[model samples]
Target: MTADTAKNFGPAFKTNWWARAGWLAGFLYAAYAANYLDVSWARFLQGLGNGAAFLAEMVPPNFSRWELLAANLIETVEIAIIASAFGILFSLPVGLLAARNLMPSWITWPFRAFIALCRSFHPVIFAILFVKAVGFGPLAGILTLIFASIGFIGKLFTEAIEEISLKPLEALRAAGAPFMSVIIYAVLPQVLNRFIGFSSYQLDANLRNSTMVGIVGAGGIGGTLFAAFQRFDYDFLAAILISIIALVMLSEFISTRIKRVFQ
Candidate 1:
């Protein structure tokens, strides 16, 4: 090799010894941790056997509880719809405020913090808190899911807003348009499709989570399913699980239609 090339390259590119050692240490520690956790082949076999028995019992789902299931399903849908609607509406303003490229740091920071706070808890945990604050019902579930949706879509919407083309926005400002008018003409056009996408995605997620919030007595099929499980009614639990899967799939279809329509 030339002297110049050797000087530029320094020593021959040897792998870092520490990095190789770290990998080996990590692998060994993972094995040790697994052993410490008692995750043995015997435990795996026992779990598999239990799972097989559970599946066998669930083969014939009990649709006899159709009336109860239907009622809870409707409640879950209502919670999802209400939560999604409110969440989207509220997130619009919050997301706009949180977009650092659109707003000053002082304005964006607090809004971003609020979004972070909203996103910090899972829907089920939020549902429990809401239930404690507001009592058990669809109302608690709705509130919990609303917070969840806002956390999700608000952050996405803010990022979309931040990434929007500034050319149009600058032109609007150069023309002496007010902030609101500039937002209407410049910001909205660029981000509206993305906003629709985020909203639809949140709605689909909310539908699935709404059903689960009921496990904490916030209201929905989850409560019924949990009760059935406690009673060892695997057939009924299986039926509920099937219905939830169907519901989520249907919601996904509807969300796709909405996205296409908006796009």
Candidate 2:
């Protein structure tokens, strides 16, 4: 190209005016929000000091109530396991029904809406409702996690089914296979690995959420932990926190192993 023609060309990099405006608007809105909330450097520094003091009080954690801790931990595990099983079992049919490629729009719509409803609220909110309805305990916790697992894994499961190659499904249908047989022979194999992965991940999530639901009286270690905090038993609270951390880590490790085995 001639030097004059090259010079007439615009710069290699062009500015995105819309993006710049969006960023500026976002920054201005953030500043406005901070101002509206009365956020200040003085309060921030005070919060830091209070946080440091709280950390100091958490040292040398106490686990004196080992019996109580063990009982609640067991309850949490039970809630997680039962909820995971129920979620996986129920999600399969609902997910299959929701898959647009498999089921008609008329059939998928209601199931899809149900899944959306399940996912609309946080687990804690569900726990609160269940606690009120059931009058508290592990049953409430289990029910809460079950719906949560359905909301999460069900959507993924539908996507997984939808994404499967249709050739195998068509071949099975052409070979005079029944719909159920096609699902068993053609659909399940294609999506089994993904389904297992989703279930394991959901189980891990249920375990973590199970601990928190107890705070709302759904039943678990969270209730004990909340009581400790209310009584200002920082050492006991520290122990409970540590135990929850350890439980979560252990669940993560187990989930990883399960995924590896499937892979």
Maximum-TM-score candidate: 2
* lDDT per residue as tens, model 1, 1-263: 68998899887987799999999999999889989998888999999999999999998998997999999999999999999999999999999999999999999999899999999878888888999999999999999988998899999999999899999999999999999999999999999998989999999999999989989999888899899999999999899999999999999998889888987
lDDT tens digits by residue: candidate 2, 74-113: 9999999999999999999999999999999999999999
Q: After superposition, how far is residue 74 of candidate 1 from its true place, in Å?
A: 0.7
Give the poorly placed runs of model 1, Cα more than 4 Å off. 1-29
lDDT of each prediction vs. the true structure? 0.93, 0.94
Q: In model 1, where is the ten-residue run with the lowest total lDDT?
A: 6-15
Q: What is the TM-score of each candidate against the true structure?
A: 0.89, 0.92
lDDT leader: 2
Give every collision pair in model 2. none
Alpha carbon deviation, residue 112, candidate 1 (Å): 0.6
